[model samples]
Target chain A: SAVISQKPSRDICQRGTSLTIQCQVDSQVTMMFWYRQQPGQSLTLIATANQGSEATYESGFVIDKFPISRPNLTFSTLTVSNMSPEDSSIYLCSVDTPPAGVYNEQFFGPGTRLTVL
Target chain B: GIQVEQSPPDLILQEGANSTLRCNFSDSVNNLQWFHQNPWGQLINLFYIPSGTKQNGRLSATTVATERYSLLYISSSQTTDSGVYFCAPTPKAAGNKLTFGGGTRVLVKP
Candidate 1:
C-alpha cells in the first residue's frame, strides 16, 4: 500500500471563499481521483486528475466549482471555489498503481474535512 | 452506469462473533473491492476480490462476478471492526472507475 497524505486535515471556511486541498503520494501513480462524501451519504466522484490535462468531472459537478490541478505524477491539488454550506463534506484523494505484482488497489488518503459556514 | 447495493444497512455485533456482509451489483464487473471506514473517517481498503475468494487474517471476501454479488466474512470480530463497510464495483469497460455502494454500518460491542 502507498502512503498518501492530505493537508489541513480539517478546515472551516466562510461562504464565498475558496480552499485548496493538497494530495501527495509516496510513489508515482498512473491515475488519481477525487471524491466527496457528504454527511450521511455515500461517496461521489468529483473528478479524475490526469497529468498535463484538464480534469474529467462527473455529471452534476463542474470545473468552475471544483477546479483540479495535477502538476506532477505524485502531487495534485483540488480547489473548492466559492464555497457554500452545502459543500461541506470530506474530500478524499485516491491513486491507482500498476497491477503487476499484486492486485492493484486504489489507495485513499486520510481525506480533508471541509466545513463551510 | 452500475448500481451497487450492500445489505444489513445497520448491524450490531458482539466481540468474538462472526458476521457476513453482502454486496450486490447491477452489472457485471471486473473489479470489486471492500473498504472499512473507521470512526476516525479513514477509508481502509480490505479486499480487491473481483472473482473467487481471498483471505486476510480475520477477514475474507468472495466475489461471484457472474452472479453480480460479493460476500465479506469477518471471523472473530473485534471492537475495532465497528465502522461502515463499503463495497465498490468497477466495470471492465470503464477505465478503473469505481462506483461505491451505500455501505453497511457495523457496531461491534465488547
Candidate 2:
C-alpha cells in the first residue's frame, strides 16, 4: 500500500479560472494516473502521467483542458484549465504498486474536490 | 477497453446483516480490486484479488478469473460499512490502468 496525498482538499473557484492540484506519493512508482469523478457518477480516467514525457490522455480528455506534469517518480500535478460549471468534479491521483510476485494494485490519493461557479 | 458491471446498484441492510456484491467484467483481467468509498469520499482498498479467494476480518472476496466475475462478501455489517463499493479490473495488457464499474451504494441501518 502507498500513502498518497493531494493538496487543496476542497476549493471553490469562479469560471474561467484554473486550479492546479498536486499529488505526492510516499514511494517511487513507475506509473501514475489522474482520474475524475463527476457528482453521482463513476470514475473516469483522465490521463496517465509519464515520467519525463507528455501524459497520455484518454478518449474524451485532452491535454489542453487538463494538462499534467510528472517531474519525478514520486510527484505529479494535474491542472484543470479554464474552469467551468461542468468541470466541477473530484480529481484523484493514483500510483501503481510494484509487481514483484504480488498482486499489483493502484493505490489512490485523497481526492481534491473542486466546485466551479 | 474492458467493461465492468456491478449488480444491485443500491442496497439497504440492517446492522449485523450480511450482503454480497457482484462484479462482472467483459474480458479476462490481470488485476481485480474492491474499494470502499466512505461518506467523506475517501477510497479505502478492500482487496486485490485477481483470482481465488481471500479473507480479511469479516470481509471476503472471490474472483473466478476464468468466469470473468468476482464476488465480495461482507458479514456482520456495521454502521461504519455504509458507503459506496466499487470494483475495478485491469486488462492484462493495460498494466495498472483500472476500469471501474458503476459502484453499489450500501446503506446500513442501526
Candidate 3:
C-alpha cells in the first residue's frame, strides 16, 4: 500500500557502537513505527514515532536505548544506542495507509540488517 | 496488547502444491494483517483483511473477525513462496502498535 525504503540495507558494527536506521516513505502517512526482529524471534514493536513530538516506546523498550525521531510525516529514524551482540537484528520501518472510510493498515520497508560483533 | 498465535510452526511443500496458513488472536482486533518475510528479510504485506476476504495473485486471505482467526491460502506454491509467514493484529485504538505471532516457516521444493 505504501512504498517504504530504509538506508544502510545492512551493517556490521563493533559492540558499544551505535547505528541509526533511516526510514523514508514516498508519501505522507498518518502513523509510523519501528520494529525489531531478533534472531529466531518474531517482530517486536520498538516505538511509535509521533511527528514533531516524542516517541512512545513499547514495554521492555526504553527511549534511552532505542531513540526514535519523526521529523516529519514521511520520514523517521531509529537509533540503536550502545550496541551489543544482542542488538543484532533486522530493523524495519513501517507506515500506515488507511483505507478510504476505513481503518488503517501497515506496510513495511525492506529492513535494515544490523549485526553487532 | 493482544496475543497472536500461528499454526504449524513449519511447513514443507512441493512446488505447485497448495497450503493454508492460520493465525489466531486472543482477543478482538480492529485490524489484521498477514506478511511474508523473504529469505532476504524483507517483510511483504500480503493481506490487510480486518474482516471478510481479499485476494491478490495466487495468494488470498480470509479474516473472520467474529471468530478471531484468519487464514492465508497459497495456491500453486512456488520456491519463492518459501519464507516466514507472520500474522500481526492491532486494535483500532492502538495506533501503529502490532503484536506479531511467532510465524510459520515454509519451505518449498521443486
Candidate 4:
C-alpha cells in the first residue's frame, strides 16, 4: 500500500481566489493523477502528471482552470485558478503502483475539500 | 472513451447480510479496479482484479474481461461497508488513466 497525503484537508474561500493543493507520496511514482468530485457525484479525472513532461488533461478540463506541476516523482501540485462557486468540490490526488502484470493498484490521497463562497 | 455503468445506484443492507454490486463496461478493458469511499471521504482500494477472481476477508471481486463486466461481493456486510463503491475501468488501448463509474451508494444499518 502507498501512503499519500494532501495538504489543507479542506478550506473555505471567496470566489475569484485561487488555491493550490499539494500532494506528497511516500515513494517514487511515474504517473500521478488529479481527480474531482462534486457534491453528490462520482469522481472525474482531471489530468495526468508525469515527471519531466507536461500534464495531459481530460475533456471538459483545461490547464487554465487546473494547472498541474509534477516537479519530481514524489511530489505534485494542482492549482485551481480563478475559482468560482461551481468549482467547489473535493480534489484528490491519486497514484498507481508500478504496473505489475495487468493490475496497477491505484491509491488516493485524503482529498482537499474546497468550498467557494 | 470507455463507458462504465454500475447497477443499483443506491443500496440498503442490513448488518451481516450479503450484497453484490455489478459494473458493466462499454469497451474492452485491460484493467479494472474497485474502490470504497468512507463517510469521512477517504477512498480506499479494495481490489485490483483486472481478470479472474480474488478474495480478501469478507469481500471478493471477479472481472470477466471477455464479457465486459465485473461483480463485487460483500459477505456479512458491516456498518463500515456503508459508503460509495466505485469501479474504474481502463480501455485496452488507453494508458493508465481510469474512467470511473457513477458508483453505488450503499447504506448498511446495524
lDDT of 3 by residue, B1-110 (tens): 67889988999999999999999998878788899999999888888888999999999999999889999999999999999999998865675478899999999999
How many angstroms is the interface RMSD of candidate 4? 1.6
Instruction: Using TM-score as the measure, name the better of candidate 2 and candidate 3.
Output: 2
TM-score of chain B of each: 0.97, 0.98, 0.95, 0.98
True contacts kept of each: 0.60, 0.60, 0.83, 0.77
Better of 1 and 2 by DockQ: 2
Predictions ranked by lDDT, top down?
A: 2, 4, 1, 3
Residue-level lDDT of model 2, residues A1-117, one tens digit each, is 889999989999999999999999998888899999999998999999999999999999999999999999999999999999999999999888864323477889999999999
- Interface RMSD for each predicted structure: 2.5, 2.0, 1.8, 1.6
lDDT tens per residue, model 1, A1-117? 789999979999999999999999999888899999999788999999989999999999999999999999899999999999999999999999754322357989999999999
lDDT of each: 0.92, 0.93, 0.90, 0.93
Q: List the residue pairs that clash in candidate 4.
A: none
How does each model score on TM-score? 0.97, 0.97, 0.95, 0.97
Runs off by more than 4 Å, candidate 4:
A99-103
Off by over 4 Å in 1: A99-103
Docking quality band of candidate 4, CAPRI definitions: medium
Q: B108 in model 3: Cα distance from truth in Å? A: 0.7
Q: Tell how far residue A70 is off in model 4, in angstroms.
A: 0.7
Per-candidate interface DockQ score: 0.61, 0.64, 0.72, 0.72
- Residues B60-93, candidate 1, lDDT per residue (tens digit)? 9999999999999999999999999999988766
